[model samples]
Target: MEPARLGSHLVVHLNRLKENFEALKKRYKENNILFMVKADGYGHGIIEIVKYAFNDLGVREFGVATLGEAITLRRHLSSLPFEIYVFSDLQFFQPELSELYLEYRLIPVISHNDDLDVVLNNPKFSNLPLCLKFNTGMNRLGLSLEKSEEIIKSLKAVNRCKIFHLMSHLANASMPMSTNKRNIGQKEKFKELKEQFISAGIELERTSLANSGALEQESCKEETHIRPGLMLFGATSMAPQHVDKSWWQGKIISELKTKVLNVFDVSKGDPLGYGSTPCPQAGTVAIIALGYGDGISTRFMGATLYHKGVAGKVCARVCMDMTYVLFPKGTDIKRGENFWIWDGDSKMFMELARETKTLPYELVIQLTTRVPRIYQID
Candidate 1:
């Protein structure tokens, strides 16, 4: 392996990503993979994944969360013919966003009636492709089924705005057997909305609503296109206990390792980090470069680290840019030695989530964008 990069260098396993894409294609052969490249491909480096999927893996469409994200991706793949769509609500960025949609040939997911006007009224965008987003029940984004119908009628009157796709989001497809009525209601409403759109003469080039949750459910795969996020990174879908099996199936996509900046010997009674947390027995302590500022949450305080196949527990509260771990007496550790924080053999992220009482998605996204992403073929 190469020298460990400081801060966070998410090591994406391109091989595993390819395999996951294949599995999804096999499972939903009729649907297209709108591989979610949002949040910089969920902090795994969007540019690398986009290129791999389009050039080698046969994926033709990508989804982003913001207009800026879409713009950044377009810069990277200037000549790729793949279609790019922004999955976020269209209301936030009006004329400017609408203009970008027209210029880049990008599709904006419209969730509100006013959103349609932004595109239709903009002289520069009156003739671009648009994706109508129906809210079925997620309620986070997308227009209600009734409002969506009206928007369709309005769009039909104009010979401009080309309709590319009709889309919706799933609220609880991850819990395939959930007895939650909300999930049931959302599914029914989304299905009905799709049928209504077709009956209203609002023909979409493609109809899609399956997200990661929907892809996990047999019923959700009926859609013609599905957008998958965490699943592509091999994270467990809503169920933490099911993680071990997922790990084996997908290679560790993000490997966060930091270099040891210093090493010191401390007495058993010596006070450690903020608030004077006690040092672990009398032993040598090694400090690693990474902390909350770099996106390593404070919950990582008591998390474990792997050095040369041996496990060591963090001995103090994590600082804004560093953390210390106690090594057993006379253990071999050096200033430049690498420490694995969250990688193939370590469950630091899972452990940290347990300490903070949170989920993997929160932990994953909390990792800031400042951290450098290093991509490699394995």
Candidate 2:
């Protein structure tokens, strides 16, 4: 933020990221946390977020979506002690990718028989550490719970890696689990599978099912580990407790800011850009450099951008490379003044999302690489 950074840019605050992470750790002290680094660390730059999480936060495990992401992280972070799990990927089951999985020390989640078969048939991967994902109630990529006995029996014979995590996805984690039958059933079934494993004389090393939203609810209790994606980056799907909410009080990790490109006067009768939309009121008109092409769509036309302690409405249609803002009449402004856009704070972010009929997840991920990211580590 020093020297008034010009143009539209995302300021990545590593310090806030640390605070957000520590807050999760403080409350969930008993359960291990696997930082979800998929989708390029939820569009915050994978390498940057991973390195910080590993070195500064002492995070030992990460979860990615593809074989490429797992191998790529292993290459860049050769010295770090970490575990990368491929949740769902066609590449994960390919015979060609089997060696890369062993070489990179990546753990593959066996969602079905083929995923487990690929590992069981190959001597190289037969002994590799793996996670078993069960369908429970998600109906996504997971084996049926009844296959728990057969799957564990197959793995118990050849696996030497100490990792044995029974994993599943909660279809209704965004809602309260105590009130949702599907979520409760998923948790109960997963627990039954764990007991089934113990009955077979193999104590599973861990069990995981919690995501960002699940951590705030009662479902987080039984799990030995939690997978946090969005919350670690400064936004949560659920309302957080006061202790955790305090960290997101005044600031955010990813600060979206843009400089005012132009300032003009628009009378009530004057026509505006594109479509010649007549001005709604006589106000101070300011143009910014961010637009639809930058991932901010037309849905944000009415959202507000804060500048110099005042909020200006995005009055005109968002163009490919520019947007028009309308401030109150006689508002003081300049072409180079910085305007605060989205800050990745759940409160403000969700507010904008409500106005735009978008999700906070959608907005953050939509920001293209065109909006350069400036790292702040202090």
Candidate 3:
């Protein structure tokens, strides 16, 4: 393992990423899987992940959030035949950039009526597929069901409009499909649109609504394609005790490690940094070299830093440049010894997410570029 170019950095376990992908494949069972490579592969170097998926994992399709991500991907692997779907890019509708779409084989997932109009009104875009997106219940991207009906009515005249794919998103799939009202409603709405497509004689090449969390819901299995994002980067976000039959707790592939910058004894009544909270007991307090500047926040006060598998309680509120951890007096930790701000343990990561009151997605993408990512292949 090469040393990280920085004092604190992420060790991205590419092999574990492969494991997670395999797990998702087994769960999905032969369905077309579209890896969500957007947000810089969820802040895990995008190009490396894409190449590994294409050349090593045999994945042929990916979904990104912008033309810039797709364009940058195309520039690197120009000759590869893998597909890149831009989920929310208005740039693809621009006539000036339209050529790049064909050149790069970029498929734009259109959600708005006007964007769809841009494609329908132009002859150049006629040859491209209609990768339509509808806002079933996410209320995010995609058109409303009523608006979608209006557009599907208009598409009847455009014979060249290949209804290649239909896509939507779920707002709260973390709950059970049987009890989650929003999930049930969204699935029904999406199915209604699919039925409409069939009735209108519009053939869809694929359909997707399942993101990382939704993969657990059986309702999503009916769709032809699955778009998993956070899980691919090794974040299941499921609590250990709550994991059930449908749990897709993939292997964590990223580990955030930071070195101990300083170590000193603190009296039982002595105050720790940035807070009036006294040290619980006389112990050795270590100052970790990483903090909020590296994406860790004061909210992680509840996180326990682990060095050599020994847990140390957070002694004070996290600072921008450092965090204080109180270890037992005789603990074998020392300055320069790396502590797992978070290692590749999914449970530890979940605990930190719980402490920070953030989604696992936020934790990964929040990492600043200043914290270098070091790939761990084996």
Candidate 4:
């Protein structure tokens, strides 16, 4: 079925996503790549991204934040043999949920001790595969290094449950220096815990510690697996100083576009928008069918929007469904012409992120579902 077109839409380039994945693959040739597809593939539409990554690129592992996301993906790709890791702690682990995980063959990342106990003690999940996360530095989730011995002992006692992987997160891998102290420290801690378990005769099949930022560092390059989310979607994980933009070669995957709804000739000192900010001089104002309601940040005021190789500044405060763009006198722009809010230009997107005081990831994910998503392989 053909989807209805909207005034404002996000065009996703699946080819660019594949290019980004290939770039990462070249850099981490020996490691398992667990593409992170949480937050609906960072708001790029998870189902399509998964199909392209799995069927076309041979990505066999995925990481999502919640059980619901995993379940949705599982239902969509029921026939494919792939592993989905749930990153959230098991606060809601129950007999029924355990059975579902077993039936679906989902791997749960046990972060807290209590959650580990529940999973190990649950009879339904006795033979289920599990991943143990350690709190090396992120301190957000995962068991502490001090509890490594206890966790090892617990896992050793488990008769049916099997340990699939050991994982930790690097907190500051995106810092300026490649050899960040915190990143190094976290890697060391994780290594120590891994060794302790191995020496105790517990076979940890795989270990993952690198995120998108850590993938660039030599310290994190040797992990058995690397879980990348933003980079896979063609967005940078850190500031430019920390990550070389040239190395990424990641094209912007989403293009945000809208049409000029109307054009108005404003006189000097004329009040504009909700704030009634007066225009400094006579100029042409182009009203676009997009605003904060569509995830266009109010901070985007004074930013540039491009049309036919010409750029104009947002003149007034953004409204819920409309925004005003100011152009020079005698400009040839007409009503109903397409204007690019974000044109899949890397430099422009970076500037937008800077103007909004947020990361590229935040900007893309903030795109509300009100705007339709159109997928294009080319």
Query: Each candidate's TM vs. the true structure?
Result: 0.86, 0.90, 0.92, 0.93
Writing each residue's lDDT as its tens digit, candidate 1 over 13-56 gives 68877777777677778877888878878777789889988998
Write one digit per residue (lDDT tens) for candidate 4, span 1-378: 445355788889889888888888888889889989888889988888888888999999998898888889999989889899889934354656756677778888888888788888767767677788989889898898888877777777875334688899878867632456886688788888878877888777888998877664434666788998887777676767756622665678999888889998989889997879887678899999988899887888878777776777888899999998888876878998887888788878877787777788887788889888888887
lDDT at 111 for candidate 3?
86
By TM-score: ranked, best first? 4, 3, 2, 1
Q: How accurate is candidate 2 locally (lDDT)?
A: 0.78
Q: Lowest summed lDDT over 10 consecutive residues: which window, candidate 4?
A: 89-98
Better of 2 and 4 by TM-score: 4
For TM-score, the strongest prediction is 4
Better of 1 and 3 by lDDT: 3
Best-first order by lDDT: 3, 4, 2, 1
Q: What is the lDDT of every predicted structure here? A: 0.72, 0.78, 0.81, 0.81
Clashes of each: 0, 0, 0, 0
For model 3, how does the per-residue alpha-carbon lDDT over 144-214 read when each residue is reduced to its tens digit?
Answer: 78875667677877764348889889887776666679978988999999898788777788888888767
Error of 3 at 290 (Å): 0.9
Q: Which is superior by TM-score, 3 or 4?
A: 4
* RMSD (CA, angstroms), candidate 2: 3.2
